[model samples]
Each structure stands twice: as structure tokens, then as C-alpha cells.
Target: MSGKIRACYACQRNGRLTCRRTRLGEPCLKTYPLECVDLLKRSRVAFQAGRTLKEGFRLAQLEAVVQMLEEHECGFVDALGRDLHKSTTLDECLMVSEPLGVVFIMGNWCSPVQTCLVPLVGAIAAGNCAIISPSEYTAHTAELLHRLIPFYLDNECFHVILAGANDLPEVVELRFDHVFFTGNRKEGSRIARAAACTLTPVTLILGGKNPCYVDQHCDIAITAQRIAWARFHNAGQSLAAPDYILCHTDIQAQLVQALKCYLIEFYGSDPRESRSYGRMVNLEIFNRTRDMLWRSGKVAVGGQVIEAEKYIAPTILTEVVESDPIMQQDVFGPVVPVLTVNNMDEAIVFINKQEKPLCVYAFSKNNEVISRLMSETSSGSFCSNDSVLQSLMVALPFGGVGASGMGSYHGRYSFDTFSHRKSCLLRGTRFECVTYLRYPPYEDRNLSLMSWACTLSQRSQGWCQIL
Candidate 1:
């Protein structure tokens, strides 16, 4: 029964299905614990039928996805709010034979909508059937996708399933051409292990403690404002949020004061009453974040927590050291710890001592400081004078390094991710005389000729390389 189908959790009890009619007046049955085996078989059949291979059909499907998003924009916005209490917000070469058949996409609570659909777009663009599983934590968004995707895309080629933690192992056992996952390290490891059993390719867009360095040479006020927004946006349930701050000891107090002033300016004197801020996803996340806030250094700014609302105020911590509990993991919350470094060198050393982060941020007007940070340190991505905005540009590839994650997808990178470029060499028998050098009758002259023909040089119009 195992096949290419993705599954996510809405908690076992929350798995409810409702019947609805499609735009064409066709009855769409939403079933719990979907007939995964049947669904995978049908999707495989559709792929083998070659319906998705045509450029016209692929383009049509892509357009339908856009139309669906445009028509259901309000529904998605409301669903996002319910899920996280927050707000808004490729190409190939050679033969480009076809897609990697069926792709299983499993997303997490962080940016549930984007994580699920962005990969799906790539899969569809590359002509692959997909099974999407939105994060179980964002049940409302999951349910919304479950209702909307089938209505717009080809039902036989696309399916959305809502499954719980208990179903994860069984669903992942299904053989798929590719598997894409986004979440924390623990679950990522589990997914990787399972995919390895079948030798299936996997793309992991995981999270880590992204670091931000506040240089004394830069405008503390501007730096403070930018960091505050990136760190606290969407109530800080962001994977790209600045997880911690490493600033020069000379301007530590000044930086802290500037951050406090801007926090007030942005969210008001009391953020709890502010409409701009958001809350944690659930009780478990709230407790973990709240505990980090208390166990870490003394709060320099906002540190209020309301369990009922799952709200953790936009907070900054002072007197923090590297050994603190909050520094150990990605503080996927509104709270950020500020650790002081004697100089840029100290900050660089401190940063290098830890696991490579998803992003390494530096705020400095001096180009040398920015250059030094860019060259000396390594992360999934690097940005100067800003935070998470580095990943926003479609032109750039976004992913992580080391424990952060591997593989990147954005714009054309996404298209390439789901595509299997089938190499085609349409050789003709007319060239048999020239190709005879590669035959079994090897000689020094033939070897020399082959090497000369294959070697690339700087004089060549293409990329220069040594053969």
C-alpha cells in the first residue's frame, strides 16, 4: 500500500471532513485518513499517462494555481490568522525530460502556507504530480488547503492529506520520487533516515539559530529598528527571525536602549494590547518560549507572557552569555538574547564556535566590516544591515548550511529542484568514423585526440575548466 503520499498532523481528534461542490458542480468528498494507497496509485497513473508532460498542460496548471490564490486570498488570510495569530506575508537545461514522478511535500508550522505551496509550484512547473501535507499545527491552514487545492488543480495529480504524528512513520514509508520537508532538526533527521531507506532524494528546509551582529560603526537606531522588526514579526514564530544578537560591548547599552525605544514605537508602550503583534502557535510552544525568557538573562525590555493568549511580548535580554539555555537552540519566539563581544573579531570567533546558522547578519556602514563578516563566516545565507529580508528576493537561492539544512529553492531554483534533467544525446550513425576512438581498440593517438577534444580552456566561449 505504500506509495508517494504526504501526511501531516491536525491532531487525531481534529481530523474532520466535510462535503462540498466544486466550481464545475462536481461533488468533492473530503475524507479523513485519506485512502492514501488509492490516492497514490491514481497520482502515479496520472503521471504515467503523460498528461503533465505537455508544456501547455503544465502552463495551464501553473495558471490555475495563481487563479486559486487570487480568488481565495481572503480565505487564506483568515486561515493564517487562526493558525498562528499573525499577519500577511525555475529552470533547467539539457533534455529536461520530465518531473521526478510523484513528490511528497511535508511542511511545518512556520510559514505554513508558503512552505507548502512554494514547493508545490516547483513540482507542478517541472511536470510532477504532488501530495501536499501542510503542518499539523496550522490546522486551519491545512484544512483550507485541503478544501481549495483539489478544486483548482487536477484532482488526480494533486492531493492534500491531513494526518497526525502517529501517521507520520507509516506515510513516510511510501515510496516517492522526491520528498521535501521543513521543520526542526529532530524531525528532519527522522525524515532523512526514512527517505534514505529507499534511496529517495530529499530536500530539507530546516531552521537554526540565525545570528545578527550589531557593529558600533553603524547607526544603532536604524539597526535596532530593522532587527526588532525581523525578530518580532509574526510574533517571532519565524524561522528566519534573528535568533540572537552579538554586539560590541562599547555600544551594548546604547544598542539596548535604541531597541527598547523602537520596540515601543513599533508596538506601543504595552504590546499585549497592540494589534500589530501576534502570539505563539499553541500551549506547548508558549511554555517552551516562556521558559526560555525566564531562564535566560534578565529582560532588558518587554518580557510579559499571557498563557491564555499564548502571547510573549517583544522582548530583549541583557547580561546573557553563550552558555545560556536560550542560546542553545533556535529561539523560535519573540524573545531575543543579547550577548556582548569586545570587538568584531570577538563576535566572529564567537559565531564560528557554534553550528553554522541559516543566516549571518551584520549591520555596519563600513564596507570592510561587512566584507570581513561575509568572507570569514559561513551560513546558509549572509546579509549586511538587514535581517530576514535576504531570503525575500526570488533571484537569490535560500536554504541553510551544516545542521541548518541543505538544498535551496527560489524562482528558477525551485523549478530545478523538482525536475529531473534527462540528458539526451541524439547521436547519428553518420558520425561513426569520429566516434570510433571510444571503441575497444584503444591507442595513444586516440587517447590524445579524445583528451584534446574534451578539455575546456579559458580561450573557450563557455565556462573555463580543466578536464
Candidate 2:
């Protein structure tokens, strides 16, 4: 468990590992060999033995997880701070459902702790054996979890595998009851394809380019402040953050000015000097984000990028078009692009033309404006007059729609995601007379009686009541 391992050059060579450029030179990451088949066998054996099925056992494991988080809070914080340069914390079932035997969870790098632990929590609560692979890009956090999880949870039932992207193809080939993945669309597609070969169920939480509309009727200052906070937080690494702004042309200038002021207040004149702001996860992300900032639109606000720091200032791009490089992909950085539209209808049309997003946001004081945006546009979720707040609450089920993602999870939804609702019915021998009618050779009278019994009718007026 010593932190003396070498940097994972293998991870960087793979095209899939895009989130791994550390600020102060890459840290050494501990990776495991591809022993997934044996691990899956162990998990299956544990599930069959019914060790995880017991309520007491599940509760104990869950409690252990809470204790582990509490005991090693600083360690986790330090690991995450190193992995993604995060500065803050974010804070998530159901039916007569049983465990889905085993769950395979692949966490994302944006919020490594949350993406990994939230699904793990649900899997444990639902009484399933789980195998988790934290993002290799988030090396420190992944290695820390690999070390800490086995100590807290049952090593046989809940296992952590820290492997590079090259190992994923073989890992997904092995069978599991359910597969839960939080990542980009390309990698998620590959996982889906592999899972499909085994006919395994999957939940993909893929991030997309979420759009936010700014109406002339809204308070520009408040709207700008909320957008800036939501967009610039975590260096705009959040999947739920508003990707681009669609503002009315008349108020576009005002909104841009307001956003500039708020950005200065949130991260000071120089965001690179601000401790509250974070850096990109890796060089790949930094380069991609920087390219978008340079190729698209005029830089109305911060558009600075320091390659060595893997830093992109909290930037705002104006005069951006739909075809811009930034608009084409999920701008998973602290860059907010603005596209001016003549009105709400034009904005709606623009939004509808693209893939549905994780969430759709609209800022307006008018209730009708909010209602129109919510009703007309389709997304995983809709937030009015604000951004990124809808997915924070555990009460809300978080997910994406269409190309964005599939399935929801948070609170009870997570429990459901990892569980199989097995319907059951028990009857006594004494009730044999109630089923006598349909047991014999079928007759017209029997059909009539069955139909009457099944019909929904008022009391005392139906044959069901008489029976």
C-alpha cells in the first residue's frame, strides 16, 4: 500500500484514458492485473452462499462503509484533491426487491468519490455483491479506494479492481447481473456493446452538452451568478453543469456583462491564482478544452490557459454558433459559451435539433416562460431559473435521456437500479374451493363467472361482491 509506484504510462497510451494529466507531474498509480474472471467467480460464490442476502449482513456492511468514510475522510479528501484538483464536496430505494446477484460499477473521473461510492451504496443496500473499477485517470483516489474498501467491506463480496483502459475489454466480457457505468459516450458505448453480448442489464450515465436559456424577463445579475457558480465550480468538470447559454439577443450583452462580474467575484481577477478553483483532471482534457476556447467565438471574458498547470480560467465565449468546436462536444471544463437567439422559440428549436441532455435549464421570472421550456423541451431533467441544483438532492432521481444516458439513480432509485423485483404470491390449501371454477373442463358458465369476478364493479352490485 506504499505510494511508491511509477506513473501509469500504459494508462496514458490508451486513447480511452483522457482524464489523467495531473497538475504537478503525474503521480504513481497502482494498477492490478486482469484477474476479473476469478474475482467474478468469488462474487458469484458469495452471492450463492447467501452471505450478502441476509439483512443483518447488508446493514453491517453499509454501516462499515459509513464508518470507513468518517474514519478516513481526510485521506479520501487528499486523494481526490490530488486526482482531480477538486476543492469541495457534493452530496444520494424501493420495492420487495432482491439483489441482482452481482453488479459491475465503472466510476467516472469528474467526481470519482461520488460516482464510485453512490452506486456502491445502492448496491450494498440492495444486498448485491459488487465489483467496482474506479477511473484509472483518477489514480490516487482509485488506489486509495482499492486499499481502504477491502478493510471496511467484505473482501469476497465487494471487490475493487484498479485496472487500466486496456483491461476493460476483457473485464466486460465476464458475466455479471448488472453493469453500471458513469463515463463519456464513446466508452459507455463500448461497455454497452460488451454487456449486450452477455444479455446483461446496464445503466449508462453519460454526460452531454446541456443547454441553458437566458430570457430577457429574468434578473440578469442573479441568473449570471447562478450560472457562473454552477459552471465554474470544480473547474466545470461536472456532467450536470450547464454546457452553453442560449440568451435572447436583446439581453445577451447585459447577461454577458453580469456573468463577467460574477466570475471575477467567484474566482477573483486571476482564476489561476484562486485556491477555490480547480484544474483539469489531465492534459488530454486541458488540451481539448483549450482548443474549444480558441476555435470558437470571441472571448468576452476569461480565456486563459496555462498548459503546465492544466489550468483554463473561468472563461465565457460569446458569438458562438452551433457548429463551433465547443458546442459540438460536452465542454467539461470551466468554459461557458453563449449563443444569442432572437426569442424562446428559436432557442427551443436550437435545443431540440441536438441530442437531449442530462438537464435543461431556463432562467426567467415569468412562470409561463419556465412552463414552456419545461413542457416543450425534452431532457433528463429541467431546472428553471437556476442550474445544476436539481441533481444535488437525493430526493430527485438523477440521470440523462436519449444519447445523454439511460436509467436513473439516487436515494431509492439506486436501490432499484441494483435490484430485481421478484414478484411472489403464497396461497393456502384451504382456498382450493375459490379456484374450483377454472380447474374443470372449461365451460361457458365458467368463462362468464371468471369474467364477472375479474370485472371492476361497485360493492353489492357485482358478482365479486356476492362471492
Each candidate: RMSD? 24.6, 24.8
- Per-residue lDDT of candidate 1, residues 1-467 (tens digit): 33332222322123222223333456443333456545554776788787786778999999999799789989966875565353211011136457899999987897999999988988999899999998889999999999999999999999999987456656777889999888887788888888888888988888888889988899988999999999999999888888999998899999989999988999999998899989899898899999988999999898889899998999999998777889987788999999988899998998899998888999999999998898789999999999888788889888888898988888888889898877644333554544567777889988875554344223223232221
136 Cα displacement, candidate 2 (Å): 0.9
* Candidate 2 segments whose C-alpha is farther than 4 A from its true place: 1-95, 456-467
Scored against the true structure, residue 390 in model 2 reaches a CA lDDT of 92
Task: List pairs with backbone clashes in candidate 1.
Answer: 8-163, 9-136, 90-412
Winning candidate number (lDDT): 2
C-alpha lDDT of all candidate models, in order: 0.82, 0.84
Full-model lDDT, candidate 2? 0.84
